[model samples]
Target chain A: MDLTFTERENAFRAECRAWLERHVPKESLGSGDTREGFARHLEWERELFDAGWAAVSWPKEYGGREASLFEWLIFEEEYYRAGAPNRVTQNGIFLLAPTLFEFGTEEQKARILRPMARGDVTWGQGWSEPNAGSDLASLRSTARRVEGGWLLSGQKTWCTRGAFCDMAYGLFRTDPAQKRHHGLTYFMFPLHGEGVTVRGVDRLDGDEGFAELFLDELFVPDRDVIGEVNQGWYVAMATTSSERGLTLRSPGRFMATASRLVDLYGRYRASAEPALRDAVIDAWIDAEAYRWYTFQTVTHMVDGQDVGASSSLNKVFWSEMDVRTHETALALIGDRLELDIDHDAPESAGDAVDEGAWMRGFEFALAGPIYAGTNEIQRNIIAERVLGLPRK
Target chain B: MRFAFTEDQLLLRDTVRGLLARECPPDVVRSAWEARSGRAPSVWAKLAEAGVTAMTLSEASGGLGMDELDLALVLEEAGYAGLPDPLVETVAVGAPLLEAVGTAAQKERWLDAAAAGDALIAVGFEGQPFVPHAAVAAVALLHRGGDLYAVPREELPLEPQVSVDRSRPIARVDYAPDARHRVDAGDRAALDAAVGVAFDRAAWATSCVLLGLTRRMLDLAVQYAKDREQFGKPIGAQQAIKHHLATALIRQELARPLVYRAAWSLAHRDSVRDHGAHVSMAKVHAANAARHVAKTALQVHGAIGYTIEHDLHLFQKRAWALAAMYGDVGFHRARVGAATLPD
Candidate 1:
């Protein structure tokens, strides 16, 4: 029941706050999904890596501080509060790294993690395909055995930053005799490898945020296989849990957006609708509730409890909350929300009230529910797995 | 930062939950509906014997001297059982208010009796018109002109009011202000501060109760969905019913942590900044969660939940009653709105 941070935790918070205050870029970077934006974000990631702030929760051997989960959360809160650049390495760092740590071999860890942390390599997730989404186990990608490696041949769509990412990790069918979740193997391979083609897709924000990968006998060596063959479904479940739970969408991100919404409300209070005030307040409360909820979840994790199916609940809540928070911000900003305030424009530069950010944020928040397993899928998981409802 | 209940706190909650399961089941709640007293006194006595009635009282007052965090889970159990009593008023709000602001003479006379379960204290804040259990209380603490007055039940005139949840018998108390009835005669500033904190405690406790009631309603709906058959399968097999319950569970799961954090904030108010906002956040979230669960539970239950014979209505009604008690969702949201979006 102790809610206050320990003296040590508070000290860590102070250190993070000071570091973030000094190091956060004076100007916002472009969206990390684009090629140019991705390169710009790599610079920021390098700064974080150089300062040992890139992967605070990872082991020191992996170029991290080995910070406690609580410290990691504090770091996230401070990072978001400072309006720091979005983590371009989030796919590799938050989602893939946990699974890698759990399943990667000593050699694999040595070769992969440090470089990934340093932004020398960036990763994209290759889970969703054209025919496989909510029912992910039905993916048709195959990994036929070859000499010293496997030949992968399939199409992976909705690959986040796939057009520019150095590598990708995904599940592929390894046994033609088996179906569904069976006979699948987790594999990581370079996007520039032989017989691999990547096409960028324009997203809702009109950015090249997604990519479609066409693999025609792409070779991935045995050394790149993560976890045991045919057990990739179970291993990939761990990665999905990270994506759907605490690792990917921490409460600090929403809290930061909620705080910005409050400031926006303050600026528009005179002409804002009274109902908008309640929405703004509800957004703040939702963020605060999410923060405490994460704290409770983190406490349980620290106490040696597995998050398991409950991660579905977290995914559903925060995704919906993120959408509502941004929607509220857009509503408060009124007609100015229509303005396409270009970030690169000199007049809009350094302006705190960037109306376009809210629109862009709203577009981004809409994807929260769709990605990391759609809310519909997450709800079904919660119903059947968590609540023990009938699958039929 | 550990945001969880201690073993002792959980034990105390379990003890009360077990007592309520045995003594204040759905039948007991039903019995309170038509009973003249509108309460289960034996269950209250059992809770008092378990030291739940005096959990927040000072040690000198023959109590455990615990804080709101200790009583949170217990009050939640009370909400789960739909316990028809003034436990929140007497223990969580009234007794603590007296301990904080009552004079030496006042504490000497009522505190011991309150801790011993020999007396029931009903509280009515200024904004709220009806005082719950005022007719049955040993004393009624009425707010008047920013001051508090403790009038003996015998001296207080009460007009009984019918409520949607029959287990909660509320009344409007009519009492003239007098020097003898003034509980805050010692220090006006202290009384004002204590009264403010008392309201926060009331809201936080009520939110805990609402969460408990919500859990109860959701469980009932889930169980019923599993048992009832429709279109050749159990209704729970249907995605519509399953999704409804799942959504309700999500709301409850998220709201519970906020309520717990509010308990922590109230317990550490001296060191916590803007603690009232924390309480308001809990109240709003809990109230909304309870309301949503109640609606979804009824929807899942179909026609049975609408009937008075079903047990779901008992909890649903209790949730509705308590969701608006202390402060409704809108009221608490406004409080939060002011704090976060202040002019």
Candidate 2:
């Protein structure tokens, strides 16, 4: 077993490092989650896509470089290290794209993948209804079979990027007769379609990254169905796996942030209290461990190995790690931590980079533990499914 | 770039696991604790017959020359079994240290016997003077100011000291300054490198063993949870108990990759610079996993785990002792911190 990268991997690292160095923006895009900042973030996505750097893990035929998993990880590390803008199309690029590649029709692949890859259309996930957060199977959204299409009716809450995304894919109970994971279908429908209405969850920043969907007979053609009818459970499970697995939070993101945390520590190293120092150190250790752990996981995936239960384990671990890291960064900054800013802050309104990026990041990281699936649910998965314990 | 073990190494782990399950079950560990020797001779013989002791020894030293990863896998199984020998210290740390730095004659004298399973070898890092199993072992590896020495058992007087882990007989090796055979390990730089490799490998093995022990505790606790009923049902059904085991599983899963990767880095040797840092990281993470798992496992098992009548203490004690071996949590964490800082 070897830990060091091969010459080819090192070369890929060099290429990615060079590209990110050349293309990363000269100024911070205020807050990528905000409505005003998304255009610039989209521009960054176009820049990366134009350079053939975006979606490096997708097959080359699908507008990616067909890079190895390790190489893709290298790309992520370089992407985060260069302080590049966040991927505005993450939900589409990371989640829907992979699921589509796996289960999409040739026509579906032909029509959707390129635009998704090019950031022409953004996709938001439509899981987690008002009645269903952790108990996701309790969702009451329905899709009725029609002569020409399926008519969707119900509400989906916590739709990330819903206010802005062009489309969403979610599970709907196709047969009201069958309950609890049966007779359901996965379908993709446009948010701007005729019968759809969306209201952004009001926030101080007005970014409206998450929204609530109200559907009344939203028409989605049968061609928009993902996988078999009544098999949305399996398909949605795959999507959740993507949400938890390496696709969403790669080790590079943690490593890059952790490195920044270490640099921040160097700034406060002189008068830093031991408790603060330890928190900083804990952040670094966990981040480093996560990085190495991802490498091991990549090796396994590349060898066609399965990492069952570890997917949930990874979600719990890295999400919590992300929160701890951001918290430590905030604490280490001392009084600088007080500058909690929204986009309209005086500094944010100008050409200058706004401060409180860590604070913003810390606040956003709170969603990591809660979203995708809560840690409580993940722990249950580990206990019953992985450990062979009796189900509650 | 494979992080998983090869078939051969995996088979070695399985073989040892199967043998230990049959030969050295918890009952053997319990009985061995009460016995005077406490070494569990039959189980040691079975491990030796399986060639577990000779894994890290070089072919030139009358033994198979597997790398650190191979030996680490075997040691992990031994740990999972909670075997009471100094086998981890013997094969992973002691043999490898002598092979790397010992004089040809020094290896011929010490390595052959250790590999043959006719004798056990115990190691004493300078700071932690307790060489486990030193009492009835054939030899002792003791370190002083700047030199690492392999003194015969007859040369040094052993003062027996009881530890919380009854099966592991700890001792204070009473060695005077002028009394030992100095195995020539070149200059200060060479000696330091040898010592560093030995200590790090030992620490890495100790962490792997601790991980194994913690997993055993987790397994035992989970089984008991399924069997022992409370509240008119199996307590395992309770969210409190499920969450307990779940958190333990998380800690183990998280620490596992670090342990294996550190083993890989150590096995890779010259291919990686400053590999000791990974070893320390593994030690620190594994120690934390062990601590969390043991405490939670005991809580899940309730009163039964608190008694010596049950076998939970066997693994719990070994985990706590092994965490303190080489260096404890704070020491290794500080080492990692020091490694991180820019010099």
Candidate 3:
């Protein structure tokens, strides 16, 4: 029931706040939502790491503070409250770091962990091929055995941040004879390796966050293999599990956004139509729900309960909330929303913040039900696993 | 800050769940539902004996010094069991209001008795569309002109009517000029604070009850879908049944954390203004979810569910009543939108 930080934890929060205040450039605020702007976000993450605060959940030996999960939660609250960054390195910090800590060898950890934690290297996911998105087990990516390494060849579409990353961790078909989830291997391949071409995909907003990767015999040494060969499905599942189930979304950051939106509505209240007001309220409620939901997750973590299928619910809830909120904002702005105004709320009687963010947000919201498994997928998980219903 | 419950709370949940399994089984709940008064005094007395009535009250007030989250678990379990009682009114609103805003004399006179399950307290907000189960309440608290009051049911205009859920009675109670208890306190600032806390607790607990009922409805539907068959195949094997149940499951799951988190926040008094939004979200999701689950369950059960002899309508009726109880999804969703996205 209690959501307050302990005295020591409050102190930790203060420390985090102080560090963010010093390192996060003032220009960084409200600067994300675009590829180049996101690059600046990566730079801020580097500063956070240099200040000894980035990825606090990682082991200290791997350039982390090795803090408890509760402390990590606190770090997230304070980090977002300070408006630090939008977490451009989320793939590395949230998904890969945990995998490396648990299953990778010490050498693998030593080689991959530090630079990634330091934000010096950005990594993209090479899991989804053109034909293997929903049925990921049907991936045809190949990694053939060789004297010094393995040769990988496949095309990975929908590679978020693929165009900006220097390296990628992939699940390739290491065993060509087998099919359907088995015979796969996890490999870490350099984005700049021979015969690799990454072409950015322009989103509706005219910005590129995803890319299509063409791999022509990319070489991945044996040392780069993660976990056992042909066991990448399980390893990949572990990554997906932690990403969906374990990690806590930054509640305070969204609250700040809500607060700002409130301010925005007030400034334009005279011009806001009644229907827009209604839309605004709908968006606000979704945001509030997210904060409370995260608090519940924090409670479960405090109680040492694994969130399990409950976490699946959150993935759907928060993502949809984000879309709804932005949509409301866009509607309130009217025709003015069509222009690009990223700095501050524009006074031009248009959507000063650009309708594109809202349009982009709506498109992205559709992905919520799609990614990390669709909402339908999560529903089945709940009915079968949590409710003990028959799968049929 | 940890948003999770302490180990003690987890253990408390386990204890309450186990107790309900034994005493509040489906048959027991069915009988309680069929009763004319909507609830049995003896059954309520047993709940009080189990300390369910006083779990969230201070020890000084002859009860446990548990927080709202702990009480939420109790409310949730009661809802899950479909126990016909005003547990939220008595516990969430009455006890906590007495603790936070009640004078020493008021606590001694009302809260202590309420904690002991002697003085059952309920609230009638905006009076007219009275909440089901308010007629039999010992005391009905209300909010008028930002002032909290405790008015006698006899003094107010109360018209008792049969509710959809026969287990809970509803009365359209109107306020009389001379019937209100003037809760004289400090200035406007302090009064709003006190009323706000009570509202948050009440709203959150209501949402929890709805969540419990919604989860139960989904469970019943899923179970029926598995057992009920048509044309030599289980109904659940059909895509229509699966999709219907799937949607219900979606709404139920979405409602859970919203209700739980709202309870958690109120118990801790974190972000006071946002409590209403959380409560609204929880209610919106739960109300809609419960109704869908109940309807789908009944539909899946065919003619069996429509009979007065069957228990399926009991849950369905409660869901229908609750959907309007805390403001419908549209009301709350709009409330949430305004509160969080005010600009």
Error of 1 at B290 (Å): 0.7
Taking the tens digit of each residue's C-alpha lDDT, what string does model 1 give over B1-343? 9987888988888888898999998888898987847679899889888988878888877789899889899989999999888888999999988887777888888888899888899998997989989988888888888889888888888889998888778887766788798875467787888899999999999999999999999989888988898898989988888789889999999999999999999998999988999999999999999999999999999898899989998898888888899989889999888787767
Error of 3 at A26 (Å): 4.2
Let me know the TM-score candidate 1 reaches against the reference structure: 0.98
Give one clash count per candidate, in the order shown: 0, 0, 16
Candidate 3 all-Cα RMSD = 4.4
- Which lDDT tens digits does candidate 3 get at residues B279-316? 77777766767777777778877888888777677667
- Taken over the whole model, the C-alpha lDDT of each candidate is 0.89, 0.84, 0.72
Chain A TM-score vs. truth, each candidate = 0.98, 0.96, 0.88
Better model by DockQ, 1 or 2?
A: 1
lDDT (10s digit) by residue, model 1, range A1-392? 89989999999999999999999988767788878788989999999999999999999999999899999999999999999989989999998899989998999999999999999999999999899988899999999999999999999999999999999999999998998999999999888967899999999886798999999999888999999988899999889999999999888899899999898888888988878988999999999999999999999999998878999999999999999988888887877787664535424653333788888889999999999999888888888888888887
**Can you write out model 2's per-residue Cα lDDT over B257-334, one digit (the tens) per residue?**
888888888877788775787888888889999989999999998998899888889999889989889988778877
How close is each model in CA RMSD to the real structure? 1.5, 2.0, 4.4
lDDT of 3 at B293: 78
**If scored against the real structure, what TM-score would every candidate get?**
0.98, 0.96, 0.85
Worst-scoring 10-residue span by lDDT in model 2 chain A: A346-355
Clashing pairs in 1: none
